[model samples]
Target chain A: MESFSRIPSHIGIIPDGNRRWAQEKGYQKKDGYQHGITPGFQLYEILLQYGIKEATFYGFTKDNNKRAKDQREAFTNACVDAVELLSGRDANLLVIGNTNYPAFPEALKQYANHRVHFGRGLININFLVNYDWEWDLKSLMENKCLASHEISRIDLIIRWGGRHRLSGFLPAQSVYADLYIIDDYWPDFKTSHFLDALRWYQDCDVTLGG
Target chain B: MESFSRIPSHIGIIPDGNRRWAQEKGYQKKDGYQHGITPGFQLYEILLQYGIKEATFYGFTKDNNKRAKDQREAFTNACVDAVELLSGRDANLLVIGNTNYPAFPEALKQYANHRVHFGRGLININFLVNYDWEWDLKSLMENKCLASHEISRIDLIIRWGGRHRLSGFLPAQSVYADLYIIDDYWPDFKTSHFLDALRWYQDCDVTLGG
Candidate 1:
């Protein structure tokens, strides 16, 4: 088993580039969503093997609903499937998003703001669907903290598909996250990509400001 | 004259690596602050040349005050000096931070929350001194948005010293900002560094999730 002196307790995953990966494969944009599902389980197993405490996966964003109806349905269905797949796993699962919004998956709404254990609850898994940074912060208008306050601060964020923008991840929690970008698309995830990010994270100067 | 097809209207600058640069040059860690000042002005002039509308500079965080007395004083002095230096420039200067706190520089108190037009106010310059992400969000308790709400959403954030973390910069404003990291120390700032980041941003898929 691979080991390291330091491991991020909470890792935020932004699985990007599904459309590009689909285009490159001569497939329609909507077809790429299904291909991205297997990698979710693969990463979960890796995190479990590595003993990572908590992980958050970026499902479709609220803005992503702007896409064509077929593409939106494809991604929404993929998110529901991904969450159901994790429902049978050994983790504490919570789906965070605007449930009132029509775009949010109804199947995942039962898990919203409520953590449910599948088996042993060895790790925490947060799935964000129909999420927006502004919507997350809007809760602060009435509450003292973020709507997604249940999720702890993120130690590291791993983004795939070569984009350097946060694209509206958990803003408050990501204040001190060390971002690791993988050029490969989400569907093209390799075990090596995650291991490389872990290895690179070993050298981060994590002085949360001081 | 260097130009680009797409220019970020508002750019966030995190000038890191001062202490490392100081140590490398056989100078005390505190000595690095003064050297980082000139680069700020040089960048301001470049922004003017490029017609960029707004920029925010990370001076020092509240957590930075936890450093040794000498280092704290050094960075505090640097922030004050940098703000004073900009006082003569043609920009609308607003210093965002907890002015009520004793750790904040008294000299910058006049600039807090109030936009002071230096000359013609051609550009907006926001200098963060003794700032905190939580503190910025705390304003949402009473107000509808961030304490730094006057500053619009950031388009690009350029960080020096090679760190990939936001380190508690304006969280809400940085939600979708593209991050660009420069490996060189802040004191070793080069005009080419800024230009290179702009060149790289030209091809970014500016699709805000669409």
Candidate 2:
């Protein structure tokens, strides 16, 4: 078994390139969402196995919602399905997003901005849906200071599908995070890939800029 | 002449591994700071030549203050010298960092939190010295909202040194920024490396998660 001397306390992920994955497979862009949904749980299982304290997934962003209507619908459905699948798991699930968006998935309606099954298990899982950095910053302005640490500071950020940008996953939370990028699309995500990221995180000297 | 279809509007950089660079050369860690100082100007020359709009350097962060006194002194001197060197230039220069830090460079006292020498080159140059993410966030809380756009949203972030983390380089500005990392240390940085980053960026499809 692969081992890391240290495991990041909280990891954030941006799984990208579903449309490209679908197009390359000669499938419709919507079909890619179906394939993309499975990796979320796979990643969670691995994080849980390692006893990682927390994991955050970029479920969907405002920028993501602006995609073609069909693409948006597919993504919303996939997230709902992923939530349904995770509901049976032994973990705390929280959805943090701008639920004000019109197409916010109905399946996650009850869990919006709240933690569900809080007493469940070894890991805390966060999914951001219809999230926007601008929206989050705006709220910070109005609220003065947030009392609750809703978003844990990210230790590592992994982006799948070869893209190098955060696309506004969770900037405030990612302030001091290490970033890892993989060319593999979300649908093709493997346990080995997750292991490799953990290993990479282990190799880093977390000087925090010192 | 090298060309890019779209050039980034603002670029943020984290120059790392100066000590490691010195160690590799069989010299004291402090000696590396001397070699690292010149590259900042070299990078500016290249960016100015290319007419790139803006560049931000992570000259020092608050966490960096925790290093050995000698090391911290070396970094502060290097930054003060760099700021003094740029003071005579045609570009606008700004320093975004915690000036409250007792050891904050005396040479940079004039340019603190304000843009300096708003003239010559088309490029806007920002150097972050003694910066802390938490400090900036706190100021945002007190002042209501930042006016005059203290930091332009970063388009691309490049870190020299093999590490892949931002280590607290301007998280809010980096919300949707593309990240590029190089294995070379700051002292070893070359103009060719900057050009290569532009080339790599040109090949990216900046869908911004849509």
Candidate 3:
């Protein structure tokens, strides 16, 4: 068992490769996403076990909503089921994304809120449905509301299947953050993989002025 | 001439060891920082030569306010002068800290704004002073603001005279950024180091979904 002395206070995950995982398993692409529910839930449990206080999963990007109607519906169903399962556990749920995805299902939104309202422990599950970093920064700068100093602090950043760069998630804000990249595809992501990531976080140093 | 293809979009400097740099030159710490200004400006010119757009200097953390009154005044004077010099150039200046330091002279704030306004170009030069990342993220989340995500965006992140970890600066956001760490102390940082970092950025591949 890895020591939990250095468990990260927060972790962010970019879940990737549901379609590929499904195709590889000889299941429909949607089936691969459906399969992701269990592992994603288990991953949350493992994070909780290691005393991680916060985790953010990129449930769906704005681009995902651009898929065909049938495909979007299937993906939404999978997401709804996944949220339901994870919400049953004792963790906060935060859904972060742009809120403008036309294809975003009401059921998923309702389910996410339901999880927050009923979860055993307060979990921050946010979805960024229609978020854009540049616009936000521009607005902040224009309004003179942008704080000159430190605004947000991040402990751990997890990217499940994306490339190294941020792809412009939160550019101005992430001036300083610890990052963890996982090789497992989002659909294939398992509880053990999350545990492994947490284990790495456990050893990360947060010393000032290093 | 180094290729501008890999120039870093964003650069961060810790501006460490003014006292040490001063001692090395057989001068007072105050003299070291005053002398440091020339090289810092020269480095900025090099960044412009390489087509770099954004740069941040880590000057005067919150702890600076806690230092001896004389020392803090001297540091603030140097900062004001530095700001004046950069503001006269072709750069949009961003002062990265609250103007709440008692030790800081009030005249410096207006000088900073005046210099930035004078530069009047697309160039962005920011100073990260007394900034905290965690609180900023929370405010964004609470206010329902979204961060932008664009294709092939935000090429590189540089940490000068700082460690690899996030250490509470933009914790949630920094996870996805590509980082470059330098061994040179901030006071000793030069144009070559800035160019080297830019070179690395030029060579970085920004393709997504790998």
Which candidate leads in lDDT? Answer: 1
DockQ, each predicted model:
0.84, 0.73, 0.17
What is the TM-score (0 to 1) of chain A in model 3? 0.74
Query: What 10-residue stretch in candidate 3 chain B is worst by lDDT?
Result: B145-154
For A62-114, candidate 2 gives per-residue lDDT tens digits of 88877888988898988889888888888788888777768787668898877
- When sorted by TM-score, best at the front, the candidate numbers are 1, 2, 3
Per-residue lDDT of candidate 3, residues A65-138 (tens digit): 55566666676777667766665666555444434455555656553222354456744544433344444354
- Per-residue C-alpha lDDT of model 1 across residues A1-210, encoded as one tens digit per residue: 778889999999999999899999999999999999999999999999999999999998888988999999999999999888888889999888988889988888889877889888989999888988888898988777688999999999999999998888999899999999999999999999999999999999779978
Error of 2 at A122 (Å): 2.5
Off by over 4 Å in 2: A146-148, B146-148
Question: Which is the winner by DockQ between candidate 1 and candidate 2?
Answer: 1
TM-scores of the candidates in the order shown: 0.99, 0.95, 0.65
Lowest-sum lDDT 10-residue window in model 3 chain A: A144-153
Task: Please give the distance, in angstroms, between residue A42's alpha carbon in candidate 2 and its true position after superposition.
Answer: 2.3
Whole-model lDDT per candidate: 0.91, 0.82, 0.57
Error (Å) of candidate 2 at residue B95 is 1.5
Per-residue accuracy of model 1 over B48-154 as CA lDDT, tens digit each: 99999999999998888888899989999999988887888799998899887899999889899878999899999998988988888988888776888888889
